[model samples]
Target: MPLMRIQLDSDRQTARRVVELHRTGKVHRESRDAARAEVWRRGRTPAGETVFVGTTNGEPVRLIYDVEVYRDVTA
Candidate 1:
């Protein structure tokens, strides 16, 4: 089975929320500071993350996205 990958920014609690949403109900490591992140298809719709990286002065502003993907390869 081919796994999916989702990437989010490391600012504005964006990554935190993405990880929480994709995260499975079943706990694995139970660590708030997990070095590695996990990816999951929530509700089968999204395809990929849409990040808009730029700067105005000295801060980096990014827009992240979580795609909902629905596809039954077995069927």
Candidate 2:
């Protein structure tokens, strides 16, 4: 299925931890996808969203992406 990024949260350390887990094979949850060695530590809300907690500046404060997700496509 086609997926889209709807939300990102950089307000908590849990967010960073989730992102690290997404890119690397370190930590994970049973509800998470396990098809690959490393998993994308992201999840969809009951409202139907794809959230991500990614970092850019290599710092906790630098990682901030509290947003939302959806199945909408852009042109």
Candidate 3:
């Protein structure tokens, strides 16, 4: 699977919410528009920023906030 890295600069609350939603399987619900938007995992940087890891699966998806995005080629 292709991995994606989403870095939330300063929005810790949103990042926490995203992680929680994914943990509860709400983000992967088929009834939602973001059906393919599944957060595989999450972590924190040394600087205290929240980072989310997910897969594109070749489908387009959107995030809640305007943040930096990168393709995790190493994964």
Candidate 4:
């Protein structure tokens, strides 16, 4: 198993949300943060935090993902 690192901008709230999303099969953390950031940008909350989902190391169908929860925009 490879070690996956999820990069976040020190936002615990976003991190938690990502964790929940991953748990419920809402998204995957396979794609790199660079690629996933685009998707996350689309799902920005009112707090301006972008939630990215990506898969880590697992299997083709069942892969574990790390959420790169961060704030892409600021008010």
Top candidate by TM-score: 4
> What local distance difference test score does each model get?
0.35, 0.40, 0.36, 0.41
For model 3, residues 1-75, the per-residue Cα lDDT tens digits are 233344323244444566578677655233122222323233311222223353232223333322232434454
lDDT of 4 by residue, 1-75 (tens): 222233434244444555677678664343334434543565732323224444333223222234333455568
**How good is model 3 by TM-score?**
0.29
Off by over 4 Å in 1: 1-12, 24-75
Error of 2 at 24 (Å): 2.9
CA shift of 59, model 3, Å: 28
Ranked by TM-score, the better of candidates 1 and 3 is: 3
Q: Which regions of candidate 3 deviate over 4 angstroms?
A: 1-10, 28-75
Q: Model 1: clashing residue pairs? A: 44-69, 44-70, 45-68, 45-69, 46-67, 46-68, 46-69
Write the number of the candidate with greater lDDT, choosing between 1 and 3. 3
Task: Give all TM-scores, in the order shown.
Answer: 0.22, 0.28, 0.29, 0.30
Mark the regions of model 2 whose C-alpha exceeds 4 Å error after superposition: 26-75
The local lDDT score (0 to 100) that residue 64 gets in candidate 1 is 35
Task: Give the clashing pairs for model 4.
Answer: 28-54, 29-54, 29-55, 30-54, 30-55, 56-64
lDDT of 2 by residue, 1-75 (tens): 344332322345655576677688554352132211122345433233233445555433433233333444559
Q: Judge candidate 3 against the unseen true structure and give its global Cα lDDT, from 0 to 1.
A: 0.36
Lowest-scoring 10 consecutive residues by lDDT in candidate 3?
A: 28-37
Per-residue error for 49 in candidate 3, Å, reads 24
